[model samples]
Target chain A: MVKAIDIPFGPQHPALEEPINFTFEVEEERVVDVKIRLGYIHRGIEKLAENRTYHQNVYLVERICGICSFAHTTCYTQAVEELLGVDIPERAKYIRTIFCEMERIQNHYLWLGFTAKAMGFETLFMYTWRDREAMLEVLEMISGKRVNYGMNTIGGVRRDITGKMVERMEERLNYLEERANYYKKVCTKERSILKRTVGVGMLEPSDALNLCAVGPTLRASGIPQDVRADEPYAAYGEIPFRVVTYDGCDVASRILVRIDEIIESVKMIRRALDGMPQGPIRVKVPKNVPKGEAVSLVEAPRGEDLHYLRSDGSDRPARLKVRAPTLANLPSLRKMLKGVNIADIPIVIAGIDPCLACMERVILVDTKSKKGQAWSGEELWRYANEWYRES
Target chain B: MAALNLNRIRRRLKGRVQEVFVQRERRIFIRVAEEDLRETVKTLIRLDGFNHLATITGVDIGPAIELIYHIIYKDAVVSLKVQVPKESPVLPTITDLIPGAVFYEREIQDLLGVKFEGNSSSSLFILPDGWPDGVHPLRKEWTLGRISKKVRRLW
Candidate 1:
């Protein structure tokens, strides 16, 4: 008896911070399949990035996602710099690293806030954002702006963090650590938190890698592959840190993975500040680049980010390819959704922290009945679902 | 320094490897002619551990269009670029071998106007409504009237 029940949710859901819609095909309250369609906020950022010069594209890419804006710009700039063969300064590396960690602090807390909101715990969501403000204030002190830092360039950073600023950051980190530890306990160990997350959306490691998964989603599945540690870029190879991984492969596992990384991020900032080498913040970058290709990978708050750049001495890139973590991890939705309760879909999807600007998909499924459709390797094989080939 | 799992397949019966690049610190790039792209993709993706299609990059050279299919397995990244004339850009889709390439292939088509043979939908992505026919913004010839002139403003 194969009964098909369908349900459509989103483009406007409390669980999603961006505009995204997903359909779940449920079999008696348990989701057997899902069709995720999210093209609601397709802003054409990639085409825009191509139109701008190498230097200007940094600012444009930063605006891709407000949560992890710095990481996007840094990855873009680093790739361009490599293509141009320009080396950044030592102090600038440390400063950039510090800012990246600051972005991480904000992104993780924002996820926690969204997680709280998804579970109907508005008070916890309010508290998480309240604590998040401290991180934002510190970021403003360093960058002189809140959202788009405008700190990164092709060769180096725009400014430096004075010793006084470092001391202030130290104080802020102390307070934040105390509050973050408390929130971790309340959110991960509390009775209600565990009931909502534990054992929900469990995924195995082999299944995750098969789906080309990344970020906390892959980490939660016990794969010790943090782009920072495995293929270190910037000052990550020089710094000391651990890749946080959990073997549980469930929603709870994702929460614990990000929470511990938040704690480690604090340590990275402190190390960068204390051991920062003195040097110029900016390097002189030539307008024309040599003809060559370079690839760069970095660990964003979500997962691994890949950039491929080739230059032909032109103002713009001859060949540019960017692989955001959100896109890489989308394939794992099927693995995570199988056998899970229909009500728990939001939590499982949120575990990956997807950035929708890079992902534009269609959301068309039965809006009610909550039944998921079976999507095998065949559905994906239909090919180029987005572009037309005129025969 | 680390190990990778890859199932390497040579070019099609009529195709040959145009370029083979082994990167120093990051990944590998495989360059094949346009005709053999289908065979190259099918063989590499079925490798015991190389089931994932990392990404697809489009390079506009003004005179000709280039498509680079990036494949990742374990820790190694390999790319295969197929160069096509700008006049009529079209290539077969590899979504059959690795389903993950669907979005990436779509993105290349949307940006470069290179059609993926046997794709599901044929539409523009990120192109403004009522755009001109046969105009791909990423192509080098799609000159920016005033946008390119802003090069001096960054200084």
Candidate 2:
């Protein structure tokens, strides 16, 4: 019998984009157990939001997650708007929906690239990222920023999507749709991707529901639970789109769900653009929100993003809570990591599209010797690649 | 549709809930005593079909800390609000019923100094290891100045 070893995989590792640590207990090749430690990148944003005024908190909340900035801002603004008892104009709602879908497309592409790179498919990574640039360019053109598009405000969006911008966005959307189809073909036909991802990191449907896995992860496990379809916030009530789901309950199904959702996002954006109503984008809201509390849910690219706000009849919020999708998906991630080979760690971690920062180092501790070895995330990536090649 | 769910939940949890506030179409907030949180959650999950626990939010409300377990039922957010006095900010763990709540509970424990009675893992979840004990940042007393002053000594 081989002795078990503890591999501390990140608060800073190459495979992890964020500073979250996962301690894996390994016996030979299989992982016996897992423990997760988070808050390495805790910015105290919720506490900060309490100090900032309701208007200023929009920008503060947007900084919570770089990729889902709009989702954060939207949720924040929606909660505050509810507190103020304001309904945004129909045009503003359409604009919010368009940006939400645009963000989803770019985010899924980013995840696809990173997951491909994690699986040692460098070419696919480069290609997906290249196609992702078109979506980013359109976002930059509309919001004047790539990642954190501060488009949302208390009553409505900050900027309006003009006719010229709409035309350019349409052109970009067509290109993205074509690229998405091609990538779908590649993801389905490629033998290496199939071998690497298929039947890997399974989270059963019951386990997923009990664990409260959200976004693509839950949908991939055969659950059709989606906030957009369920709650219909923003303009999702007016827009028609499918909540994509797959029953494979593995890494490959997650890949398929994301890819299919990107196509759905593309369709949603096109429809929003075509059917967008004309009206004032921004409305006047009171200086201070009343003494009320509200909860807002947005279907962020990764999963369900929830924000809660309470006012004390003051300029600032009494309290604010932001639950990013990554936090919701962490438990399911723990469930997925169990019983998998050590070599499959990177792919499984990348499969969730965790919204975090870069890693610097990793520590591997042998339980028997009580000795430790420090390694970089790149080292682990290389080790996984070599192990797969040898096997 | 949302009102129907609200009425069903109101009728089911009639005696348990202190106040049921329908903030909007799909948002329902129910205030319950600390002891009834587990049973209330059980009812929501088992009978009401509010299986998805979106998150748990804790706010330091002057004399008491407000703990809101935001559970998703269909399209609505049924937030179960329970307040525990600041002196003894302890509550039962819902992790047994919904295992995903362990992280959120630990987060509240770390930041607000709330204790989950039956939670197994007591070590810090979100805060850094060296973060000073009893310095719950989310509490109203731990203002920006106080936090910086307390956290600054560590460096």
Best by TM-score: 2
Instruction: Tell me each candidate's TM-score.
Output: 0.82, 0.92
Docking class of 1: incorrect
> In every candidate, how many clashes are there?
17, 7
Off by over 4 Å in 1: A1-5, A357-391, B1-16, B38-52, B62-64, B73-76, B84-93, B113-155
lDDT of 2 by residue, A1-391 (tens): 9999998888786375567888999999999899989888888988988887777677678788778888989988998888888999999999999999999999999999999999999999999999999999999998878888879988999898888998898899999999999999999999999999999999999999989999999999999999999889889988888999999999999999999999999999989888998899989888689999999999999999999888999989999998999889989999999999999999999998888632123468888999998878679768755753453
How much lDDT does each candidate structure score?
0.75, 0.89
Per-prediction DockQ scores?
0.23, 0.73
TM-score of chain A of each: 0.88, 0.90
Poorest lDDT segment (10 consecutive residues) of candidate 1 chain B: B5-14
